[model samples]
Target: MPIHEKSLIRKENLVENESLVIDGVDVSGHWSTFITGRSLTDYNDDMQDEIAALPGGENIHRCWQCGSCTNACTVNAVNPEFNPRYWIYLIRLGMEEELLRDKDIIWQCVSCNKCTYACPRDVVPEGVMKATAHWLELKGHTPKSPSTEFDEEFSGQVIKTGKIEESRVIMNFFRRTEQPLAQPWLVALIKGLAFRFPVFYLMRMGMAVVRRPRTRNWAKSRRAINEYVQEVEAANRAAVGAKGGH
Candidate 1:
C-alpha cells in the first residue's frame, strides 16, 4: 500500500503557502498545503533479498503492510517514528534511500516480540527489525550497536572453547565497547559474590579464570564450528555485497 499517512511524510516534503490563489479560488494556510513529488533513482533491487539472506529476515516476503506490527511495537509506542510497517514497506519496494533516513533509530528495537505475535502473516516483524539493523551496519550506514558488540563477545567465547566464562565475556565486551571495568554496580556485584560464596568456591572460580578452561575434547568441534561460521559469514557478505569486516 502506498504511504498516505501525513505523519510519515518528511517535513521538508510538505509545502504550505500562507497566501495562495489557485484557479481564481483562494486556498491559504493548510488548504494550500501540498506534498512535494518524490522520484527515486537509487533503488537497491536486491535489498529485500539481501535482508532475507540474513538470520531472522527470511520471512520478510510475507509482509502485506497490515500495520499490525507497528501497532504492537513497544518502541513505536514511545516513539512513533520507529514504525516497522513503514520500514518494511520501504524495504519491499527497494527504496534504499528512504530506508536510510531512519538508520540511526532502527537499531533501537527492544526485541519484545509483540510485533511478531500481532503479525497475522507470520512476518516476524521483530526479526525483520533486527535484520534491518544488521543490514544497516553491514552496509556501513551505521555503527555497530552495543548489543551487537556484546553478542560477538559472547558468541566468540562459546564458539572458541565450546563454553563461556561469564567474567571474561563481560570484561571483553566492556573493553571492546570502551567501557570502564570499575563501574559501581559491577564493583558491588563482585564484592557481593566474593563475600557470599564459600572460600573453596571462590578459589575454584579464580582457578577457572586463570586457566580459562574449555570443554573436554572440544578442539574438533571448535574446528567444525569455525568452518561453519566462516561459511555463513561469507554468505552474508555476498548477499549484501559488503566488503571487508564490520
Candidate 2:
C-alpha cells in the first residue's frame, strides 16, 4: 500500500527547491518538492512473526492498512506522532529501523481500545500497540516502562497469593520504580483512610499487611500459575532473541 501520511516521511527524505524551472515552466518553492528514495538494506523479515509470537500481536497480520486504527486512536488525537496504522505497516513490511524511530512514544498508548473497536478486520490494534511496546523492550530498543514494572508487581502479588493486597502492591511498585512512599498525595490518602474508615476495617488492613494472607489451599494453584508464567516468559525471550534475564 502507498503511504498517504506526509508526516510519516522523514524530513531528510523530502527535498524542496526555492527556485526551479522545468520546460520553461517555473516550478519553484513547494511546487518543486520531491521525495528522495532509498533502498532497504536492514529489513528483518521475521519481524511480523516475532511480534505475533507475543500476546495481543497474534492478529497483526489481519491489518490491511485501512488507517482506522490511527484515525480512532485516543493518543493520536492528542499526539499526531502516535500513529498505530503507520507502525503496523512498518512492522508488516519488516522495516525494523523505521519502526524504531518512534520507540520512545510507542509506549505512550493509553490502552483505550478505540482503535480495536474501529478496526474492520479484527486486527486488535490496541493489543498490537502493546505487543510492539513489549517487543521494543525485549529487543533492547527501550528500557522497561513504568507500566511494565507496575504490571510485574501486580501480577507477582496475584500469582503468589491468589489475591491482591493493595497496600503491598503500591509499596512494592514504588520501591521497584525507586519512588519514595512519603509523597504528599500518598500521605494525604493514608490520613484520609485512617480518619474516614472504620476502626475494625483499618485493623483488618493492618493484619493483612502483617499476616500476608493467601487463598485457602493455594499451593497447587500457585505452582500451576508459576509454571505457566515461566513458559510464557521463555517463549517471549526466544521470540525476540533476548539473551539476558528480564
Candidate 3:
C-alpha cells in the first residue's frame, strides 16, 4: 500500500485498508482510505477574553497573524506541532477543539523569549503560552504538567521567603513531579564542578543549604504580593467562568 497525506486528518477520522476486496472488486490501496469530517456546534465565544484576563495573556488580542511567533518559537523549531501563532488564531476564532489538540505540549515552552523579541506587535507569545497552559490545567482539560509543577514549586518559595533557594526549588520540583532527585546528568554536572573547584563548590553549596539568603524586612512586601496574587487569581477565575480560587 502507498502512503497518504494523513497529517491534516485526525486519527479517528482516517480509515485505511492495506489489502481488501469489496464485493467482487479489489480496493486495497491508499485510494480506499477515508477521512471523516466533523463540525463544531458550540464555540466558547468568551475564550479570548477569558484568557486575556490572565496575567500573561493580556496582549493576545494584538496579534495580526504575522506568524512571527511561530517562526521564532524555540519549541516550534523542534516540534512543528508546538505552534503559538496557530493557537492564537484558534483562540481568536474560538476554536477550542483545535486548541485542545496541542494543550499537552503548550507548557513545554522554555521561556527563551525569542518569540517575544521577534513579534512586531509585542504579542508576547511566551506569556500567551504560559496563560494557555495555566488555563488548560485550571479548567481540567489536562493534568498539571511537570513544567507547571516546577513553576509552582519555584514561585511558592519566592512568595514565602522573597527569595528562592535553588537547591530546595530543584528538590521540590523533582519531588512534586515524582522524579528522582539524583538525576544522572545533574549528578555528573555537580561532580564535574566539584572536581574542578572543590572549595568554591562546597562553600557555595553549604551556604545555599544552611544559611539560605532572603530579602531584609520582606514581611510587608510579601503580604502585599500575596494579597495582589489572590485578587488576580479570583478575577481570572471569574473571567473564565470559574466560581472561586484561593
Candidate 4:
C-alpha cells in the first residue's frame, strides 16, 4: 500500500485533540467540555508577579475554569456576563486591560463565597473578586462600579457627622445613583411613611445600614483583616519562592 499522507491541522484543532486525549476521559476533567477556547499565554511573568502582590491570590493558577466558580456564584446564575472563569483566565493571560475594563462586573460581586465553597480546587473566586476590586480602586477607576455611589455617599455622611444618619443615607444613595426611589410604587413611599415601615427596598438599604449601632467588635474586625492580609502576603512569598521565577 502507498504511504498515507499526513493531514494538516490548525493549532487549535491539535490542542483540542491533545487536550481530549490527555484528560477528557477523567471524571475530574468533565468541565473540559466547556472550553470555548484557551490562550497561548496561559501563564506570564507579569501575571505571576501581580498575583504574588495580592492577598490570598496565590492559587489563582489553581483555577481550571471548571465553571464551578461561575455556577456557584449567585450573581452569574442571574447575570451571565458576570463570569469569574473568563476573568481568571484573562488574568492568567496577562490581559490586564480586559480585567480593568471589567470593573463594573468585578465590583458587582457581593463576595458571598458560594463559589469558593463549590470549587473543588479551592480557587476562592470570592477572594479573587475582592483583590480585583481593590486593584480597580487603586487605579482610581471605581466610579463606574455599581456600589460606588452608595459607598461614596455613605462615606461622606459618616465623615460629616461622625456617624451615618439613616434617612440621609437612603435619600443620598437614591439621588447619587439616579435611582428612582419608586415608580408605580411612588405611592408606596407615602404608605410606608404613613405606616412607619420596618424595612427598606432596593437602593435605600444604606439608610438602614448606617443607623445600625456600631458593633463592639468593630476594632477587632479591622485588626483581623490587617492580620489576614499579612498572612496572605506571607503565603504569596512562599508560593513565589517555590516557583523560583518572577
- In order, the Cα lDDT scores of the candidates are 0.89, 0.90, 0.87, 0.64
Q: Alpha carbon lDDT of residue 167, candidate 4?
A: 63
lDDT for each residue of candidate 4 in 1-246, tens digit (9 for 90 to 100): 111221433333322222344344542233233323555543444754565356656578888879888887899878887998888888877877566667677878887999889999998888887666655554455654547567767765554445566666877788777888675575677677656754545335554565554445456655665577567545554543432211
Give the TM-score (vs. native) of candidate 1.
0.83
Clashes of 3: 0
What TM-score against the true fold does each predicted structure earn?
A: 0.83, 0.83, 0.84, 0.52
Q: Model 3, 1-246: lDDT tens per residue? A: 333668776778887788888786788877678775567877889888888888799999999999998998899999999999999999988999889988889999999999999999998999998888888877878998998788788888898889998888988888888889889999999999999999999999988988987888989989999999888788778778876552
Off by over 4 Å in 4: 1-48, 51-58, 140-144, 152-165, 178-190, 193-246
Find the candidate with the highest lDDT and give its number.
2
lDDT of 1 by residue, 1-246 (tens): 123576877789988888888898888877777888878888889999999989889999999998999998899989989999999999999999889989999989999999989999999988999999999999898999988898899999888898898878988999999999999997898788778876976898789789996898888998999999898888888889999776
User: Lowest lDDT 10-mer window, candidate 4?
Assistant: 1-10
lDDT ranking, best first: 2, 1, 3, 4
Q: Distance (Å) between predicted and true CA of 213, model 2? A: 3.6
- Kindly report the root-mean-square deviation of model 2 from the true structure over all alpha carbons: 3.8
lDDT of 2 by residue, 4-62 (tens): 56587778998888888989989888777788878888999999999999999999999
Off by over 4 Å in 1: 1-9, 25-31, 188-208, 211-213
Q: What residue pairs are clashing in model 1?
A: none
Ten residues in sequence with the least summed lDDT for candidate 1? 1-10
